[model samples]
Target: MKSLMQDVPLTLDVVLRRCLETGVGVEVVSATPAGTVRTTWGEIGRRATALTGVLDGLGVPAGGRVATFAWNTHRHVELFLGVPCAGRVVHGVNVRLTDDEILYQLRNAGDEVLFVDASLTDRLAELADRLPVRAVVVLDDGAPVNPVFADAPRYDALVEAVRETELVPRAKPDDAAWICYTSGTTGMPKGVVSSHLACVVHSLSSMTVDSHAVSREDVLLTVTPLFHVNAWGLAYTSALANAKLVLPGRDASGAHLAELIEAEHVTVGAAVPTVWVDLVGQPHRMDSMRRVLCGGAPATRSLLDAIARRGWAFHKGWGMTEMLPSGTMQVQPPDLDLDSPAGAITRVGKPSAGVRVRLVGPDGQVLPWDGRTTGELETSGPWVIRAYLDPDDDSNDTRFHDGWLRTGDLAVIHPDATVEIVDRVKDVIKSGGEWISSLALEQALAAHPGVAEVAVVAIPDDKWGERPAAAVVAADGLAPCAEELVKFLAERVPRWWLPERIVQVDALPLTTIGKPDKKALRARLSSPSRS
Candidate 1:
């Protein structure tokens, strides 16, 4: 009988002292390159307590690892609340990877203190002498500094030389705050980490009114990429819902996020689905947004009917980066049919609360969520990732098993537990033995009105040992015709899932985070002159 309450500690300094006592005058803005700046949540909680006295005068220790590589500004939301409320850990990094994946994630997260982003100091001055980082700082954004970080040190003069030092929070809701990594698209990128009670319970389960409800009269924006996964956490649920955050630095174009969501009347934006297909083809006035969220991929029901013809409210989520980036969220189930193509509007819905989700099969059994039983989705609770920070790594024997988290997608689940993902156990395709689904043939050829972008991928078919090959990209003056997108996927999928080759291209080799690389389109459709 160990009852009597009061166990406190879920840290990030209690979401930075409740966003500095209730968002003291809200607004955080930042479109920098020496431009929009702004700042508030009580001056970013006194510049994140002067960035924890510039990470304790750059010594950084207590669980170390800082690293930022900037962009989603307001000084990367003050190193996402001064490096995990000064107990230290932050990590972010991604800045569109490769420079050998940013020196293999700064030597696999031994990070230390790198900050950066004066227009990314000549790509971090060629890995600032192979960074195991101890002090680089920068952040300036008016560009022009990289004389190999001309004697480094200048995140606003080291937070104005520790702006009257006070630095309190020493963290500990199971410490190690945020590390992120995995866009290695099925390979190298690993490191997950999280905790500070799993980022304050995934920012109070993303302000739950069915997740991503995010409040304080919402105004968010984060075109996802505060070095990736955490941006998907919507910058800590817009600083624990004291909302109004914005930051579009490094122009996430589509007419600069439709003029920064119509000059910041931005009521909740989040990104991906290729930045909402370049903000549904630019040209402005965002009518104060009102819900967009989307996640790394799968949105195309003609980009959710071109973001429901701009009345916004898209919401397709489903996560990873080991699930600290969210687990599932599509919430629009009122007897479903948001223009049905087998509705549940691109289902990624159920399982956000403490996240459980199952569906195993291919013999390990545990399937039946019934909605036509496809399998391989597994997941598990309180902000997921129970492994992968290399403990004798072997990708923990194929991405963990007994404690769930295999999530190589390939979903379905439905009998009210919603889900529906449909492929990526290395992008599924089997063919003559019948499996198919390269994301349900790239969502039925992205609902073909002359397909703007698609992907599919699974080639090698001398007797159906594996068929399904697409690639597309048209829409804009339409030329569509690979037998009219296989007769528009022969009335939607399963004529042995169509496409034995479609091609078209003009762009669709993405993944530096904008996904759709399909392993570089199955090595450019298995070569020999694009097969």
Candidate 2:
């Protein structure tokens, strides 16, 4: 029973060719310290081709890993397309990480060459003696080159020196194209490899109507860091959809982003909840914006209300490093009640096409979508990673079980197929044999008028085994009252779920990726001085 069909491989080459052919008028704009720089898709395609030639001249073997430590700019976009299309794996090192963490990733991944921005030379110089890379290249961004990188060749000079080579994708569909490490708040970061087939499929899925719905007419402002999960795949989606791509260089402040959106007429944007919170009060013309995608952390009701007041469509997305950066999307249903606590807009939405999700109990039984029961979430799909890059690692045993990636998220799936993430398995509070959701408590506290930010962590208690403790940041110039916060939560959550201790802080500790550092907060709360 053989069916007749073409065996064309799905790869980034296909995506690149389509982008250049149909995106004749499309442009990629990058904000620079000097001013805004713009280039057409045709020029980017040409530059990407030259970049492949540069790699060849540098003697980087096929399938070797190339590490990039730079901001989200046009040059970064070149590596994003050039490295993968030419069969080399592009590893975008998180620039926000500490020197030790950065060194660990470079050594763990066995990166051969390091491409860095001129402004970040000081950070690179600190680890220059210990770097495993064989060569270093600098991308000039109006910053003086550090003495350590003075001997390194400039990025533009290298690309311009190499003769333009024929543009052909050397890697197969199943070959590795990109590597992204998890944030690793609790432990060491693990590498996640994305295949060309997986990337192409995910990009297509992202452009579908129910997902991001990117199109040729849309101008996408990518506020997320390019080093994290491929900027949630927005860069690739923009190319495939022939949409205009805008990159806000090193500065992501509210004022800068507002100016870019209005000046570039950005129609769609994606970033974390923290970025959106910073943008709520920025006075700018954003009437052209059609949709805003938020992830990395849950959005509070206050933040959502603020966006609603601006008359902008807001969507909450759920994903992980294992799932190619996206799995579920929040799409409003026709019958959904906007004010209901369990509405579609409040949930993380249904599983995307080609992805399947289910909940599993502690005893290994699959849970039902009764809109009340909660358990660990598990997902399986073509794009999901079967295992981490290091096969010898012990964490792989618990991360993958029975062909499903254990998401480590405690969640409830409604009968309508929407998902409500309660808390992380390690972050949940265990009091008197009952489970309490830290995320639920934080969401309730964030709605308070005086509370600007909140984080809940489990504190050890002899009586209850583990009880909830909170750290809060006050809004504006007003100081928050602990008694008032307790009263506010008393009406929303169970009486037992209330935190045993609440401490006011200037700001919540954050991870490198901007999520609340619960592990650090737990350590701070458990300190003898705090006690």
Candidate 3:
């Protein structure tokens, strides 16, 4: 006989309902073009419920894709929950992407209703006649003059016209509730669709002590863009834990973030390493932060040391758009000495709960977790995606293998279950028939004390085939000469692995999401503009 148990569906609806019931006092603060606005979870729930009215009034079909091209504001937060709960899909367009990328995503996702911030309305205007969207709703109240979108309506008017109804989720747990596209550094962007069940499971897994450890009293500031992996799942984890959330809007500047952390007493936060590097240079207090989750790229020892000196905990995390974005959160062992060469705090930690990882060598065999053997990291779990949205895309074969995602990341797995990402498979430099880690070289260069930022790329060389070339951004008024940098690395790495060229740049080129744009850098080096 089969065992009898209630099969309650797991979905974002449950997460939202739980927050509304128990998190009445929790606050959702945001800085927008209209200035700062504060609202309670209860009020947000009411507004989110009201938003459904607008969706229904506009005749948004069930499971339709509703897109947002706005910042991390209170209104955008509404779409995060409202659209999905109303039986529609939420597609957050990365505002930082190129216009071509933006247009492609807008058309590819088949967005029906486009919601944009007043300040960002001009973006829609650029593609006004060409866009596939049926309607455009501006996210402001007309305080800042709105750009005419032909026949698009204002957000304030739409919300005011819709009457608040009893809140209820319309979609099933396994239905696709949100969509996000890859960075497409290698080619055109691929879309990833996440189910309601996956997001709910990720939220619970993220609350574990090894992850963000979200809790009722924790005040978390999101420096990560909401368009990026749902801001690394904090939007849901915060609600599930009843934690206060502070959104920095379009201004994630170091100065603004520092002020927000101090003013809001933010206890935990997440951002890329570049943002933290800027924060260290800013003259602002960060005593309120207890832990910060750093991702997007590897964290340098110099950056981590600066954070450690402030009595704050620094963590390195890793993820991808296809993994529902929760891969690993590094938690150092109690007995491990961080000062040792092997104790570098840069490891991306072990896989989060409910996730499994394996390493496969080029020979198609599973590698040992001895921390020495490196291979491509493959992952599979409840939240990890099995395939891309397009089946016809040729990347499917190389990206997914036997229900596992080929992460394209070269990494070593330690016996302690920790993971150290060596480099992207395409980014590993080969010289004299030996492989060199550009990431490791950049890490060593960042420790030079005078280097503010650095990116290591493989430049073509007739003698070595490809050699490591470092682009250095010197700190203000503390320029370390290229010769001094080479000498500094000579002590740390093999002499043959040294970068053949040290190109000094005022700033390193960055991708839309803030990571170093290595593709662009390589193109620049290959061009005839080097003087």
Candidate 4:
């Protein structure tokens, strides 16, 4: 069925190859606690091509999965381009996953070639028995390779052996480039395999839409892990665009990130809402940052306001693991009132340049776009995942209808096609036969100056099927009190819609992937009932 999409092979591999030849003068920066490392495009090309030789020497099959259990360093960044372009799958393993979970994924991915950063070698060595890895490569050269694994290799030595190589074999557009796993909150994590074509489009649209909207001269901060959607597709677009890409290593804490942003003169960046909370409110210098593309969860209205007050724009984003983890973005529409109330910035905004959206009811009927009728939001387009990769082998065909994929997210579409996500379809709070959105209440509480964190969830109520509860973090100069927050909410929502109870906590229980762990919160608050 080769529909003749493009015989020229419009893949990510091809893009990087062209960049080395045409954009060799571009700057690529990687920042670590050790210090900042700088490399030009030619070096990137040489390193990546040489790494291909290392993979070939290791007997890595063309379609074999090469796994990386490492931090966000330039060396890690090299593998981001090299493995896939070399006609192999790069599985950027989530280091945050539990030990048992990590073993489960390696087995599920059947990954044979392992790349371990020196920082992770001690921990990774312990799991060598559990993985089918034929070879283990370490990123840190000075550190002795943990002898727990017999086949482990050093990353730099492998590259040095192939430094004289000029070119690496390229992958076709449809060849699998990388593998990203989705949090299996209900069970085990499933793989989301992306092809070179889908990835190329994802990165191109991302750079055009956001990615610091970086120009040739801009420098970027990739505090977001390179393991996540190729660090939210920033490296892909930035290479060809001639921007300098900065990696903050794995230290994403406020102090470390603030230091890197200032020292590197980072002009653009992306991170979750919490990563910036401490940085934005800290007593450090951040004059170089121009904008932050935030995702993994909604950035509170107050957080956005605080960053805006500092003069750098805050761009909000919403996506799932399936959309190459990119779906919609908010960039302050041309007519949006800069002085508009906090309500304006919370919405998910418009479809990305390469995606489509539809609001559908339980019956699968597409609803009109008026911003009132809410329904399960479904989307399908280039770069959108057709179905998740299941180790147990579930039917992926069912995940797609016609050509569209059911995103399992709910939203209301405005006349302008901008979307306001209410909550996950399963997360809506049901009370007295009416459904209320948990997202709305959280956004309301977030607007209050004295609230630093908030999570809205359903709790059991005998009178009503389910009631809403709010867990909050007290702001500076404010005591942690539930009653006052309830009163604050009353002014925003109808009395019936207000959270029935409030609990104060220092922080919300964020998932390993950085999203709110609503399911875990609900279990913690209430016991399972047979009713």
Task: Return the candidate ranking by TM-score, descending.
Answer: 2, 3, 4, 1
**What TM-score should be assigned to candidate 2?**
0.96
Q: Write the per-residue lDDT of candidate 3 for residues 480-499, one digit (tens) a residue.
A: 98899999999999999999
Candidate 4 ranges with C-alpha deviation above 4 Å: 1-7, 141-151, 209-212, 333-343, 391-398, 527-531
lDDT of 2 by residue, 15-71 (tens): 778656776678999987657889877667777777778888888889999999998
Estimate candidate 3's alpha-carbon lDDT, on a 0 to 1 scale.
0.84
In order of listing, the candidates' clash counts read: 1, 0, 1, 0
Expressed as tens digits, the lDDT of each residue in 209-289 for candidate 4 is 443365676787877787777788778777767677777776788888888788878887788888888788877778888
| Least accurate 10 contiguous residues by lDDT in model 3 | 141-150
For residues 319-411, write the lDDT of model 1, one tens digit per residue. 887887789887653234566644543577788898888988877789888778788888998778888886877887877778888888878
Model 1, residue 12: what's the lDDT?
81
Judging by TM-score, tell me the better candidate of 3 and 4: 3
lDDT of 4: 0.78
Taking all chains together, each candidate's TM-score versus the true structure is: 0.34, 0.96, 0.96, 0.93
If the candidates were sorted by their lDDT against the true structure, best first, what order would they fall in? 2, 3, 1, 4
Candidates' C-alpha lDDT: 0.80, 0.86, 0.84, 0.78
